[model samples]
Target: MKAALVGADGALLYEVRRATGRERGPDAVVEGILGFAAELRAYGAEHFGESALAAGVAVPGIVDAENGIAVYAANLGWRDVPMRALLAERLGGVPVALGHDVRTGGLAEGRLGAGRGADRFMFIPLGTGIAGAIGIGGTIEAGAHGYAGEIGHVVVRPDGPECGCRQRGCLETLASAAAVSRAWAAASGDPEADAADCAKAVESGDPEAVRVWLDAVDALAAGLVTALTLLDPRTLIIGGGLAEAGETLFTPLRAAVEERVTFQKLPEIVPAALGDTAGCLGAGLLAWDLVAPADGPAAVTGSGAP
Candidate 1:
């Protein structure tokens, strides 16, 4: 878990990371988040001499943001944890906003980064797990049940691979960073090989790497074309560790997408401008929103870039 103390101006004041402690059990993970939130609040007051008006926390899982409940998190092993209320109580009634991690990162990207000017955009992060954040206007669509942008569950290859979600040929199973890493590692006989290593090998003219990379790219393109056919987003913003491969991923991805499109408008497929700090910055934005009135003065940085 990562926490950042962001000022009213959306500037990052302090940051820290802690283990989720899942091995210790779900309660331990919840406590870790709550304790870190309290610690961050205390640190802000003591060091900056400013009492934080509100706090925003982004969590991974099926989150009910409206009710501030973490509905379920398979990795964290928790269900129906009232994270927002707990944080509010621990922080002495400080207002809190709960958000999904991927959605929050997409918020930052839409407001301040890659999708800045686009009316409608999709933030697809091809990471350890693939997920999407659908951005419309200034906010994201969390859906009626807060499970809107689960692009990873989209099946691209019915006979490909099994996903942790218990589905075959899901996008994550075939094209996610973790999937690519595992495939490359298995093919190259390197236990430590990751998606980046696969990219490097492909650049070095390794046939196995090329095959693995192309397979992932093909599946990714199929999934993306499906999303475009449904969402018709003006821009498709790709982020996460895999995107760090730069043109090695984008060039072929664009071509594959182009080949698949028939009547749909081709949206710009761009890399996310914010790197790892997107979710942290997004949390800061949510915090600012809770404190600032609708008609009141806005934060110094409207976009919350940092």
Candidate 2:
């Protein structure tokens, strides 16, 4: 987890990291978060002379942001956790805002990072899994049921691998960093080989690596184009571990996307500027938004859920 004390002007006043400790069980993870928030509140009071005015938390998996419930997170083993109310009570009834992790990150990216000035943009991160945030103006669309921007679940190949969502040929299963690592590990006969190694092999002109890289890129492009056709976003921001390959990924990705587009205006595909901190900064943004204009300084605490 990444926690921060942020000022009203969107400056990070203080920051810290902690383990989610999910291995200890979901109940323990909740306790850890509550304890961490309390510590942060005390830290802000000692150093800045006041407690936080509001708090914001971003969590993974399906979130009912309206009700502040973490509906379900398979990896975290959470179900219908009343995160906002819990945080608010722990913070002495201070207002709290809860958000989806990817959407929160996209919120920050839209207003303060790569998607800045873009009225319509999409933030897609190709990490252990693929997920997206759809940015409209400065806010992310959470959809009617908070399942918006789930482009990763789009079935690009019906006969492809099964996803955790119980569907076959999902975009993430084909093109996510985890998928690339698995493919490269198999092809290179190195049980420990990963996506980064595959990228290096591609740079070194290895045919097998080239094949794997292009395959992932093609899958990614197909998924992206599907999103593009629907959302017509002005900008598309790609982040996460796989995007660390830089132009080795971008150059081919741009070509592939172009090859697939016919009538769609190609949005400027860009790298994420904030990296891992985007979610933290976005969580801060959420906290700040909860503060009224009359609120002074707007000292706020924000947390990122694993």
Over 86-160, each residue of candidate 2 has an lDDT whose tens digit, in order, gives 999999998898999999999888877899889899999999999999998678898988999999999999999
Q: Which stretches of candidate 2 lie over 4 Å from their true place?
A: 293-306
What is each predicted model's overall lDDT from 0 to 1?
0.88, 0.90
> Can you give the TM-score per candidate against the true fold?
0.93, 0.95
Root-mean-square deviation of Cα positions for candidate 1 versus the true structure, in angstroms: 2.5
lDDT, model 2: 0.90
Clashing residue pairs in candidate 2, if any?
none
Candidate 2 at residue 65, lDDT?
90
Query: Where is the poorest 10-residue window by lDDT in model 2?
Result: 297-306
lDDT tens digits, residues 1-306, model 1? 878887655567899988888999999988888898888888887887777778899989889999999999888888999999999999899889999999999988887789888889999998989999999886888888888889999999888788788889999998989999999999999999999999999999999999999999999999999999999999999999999999999999999999999999999999999888989878877877787733111444453322
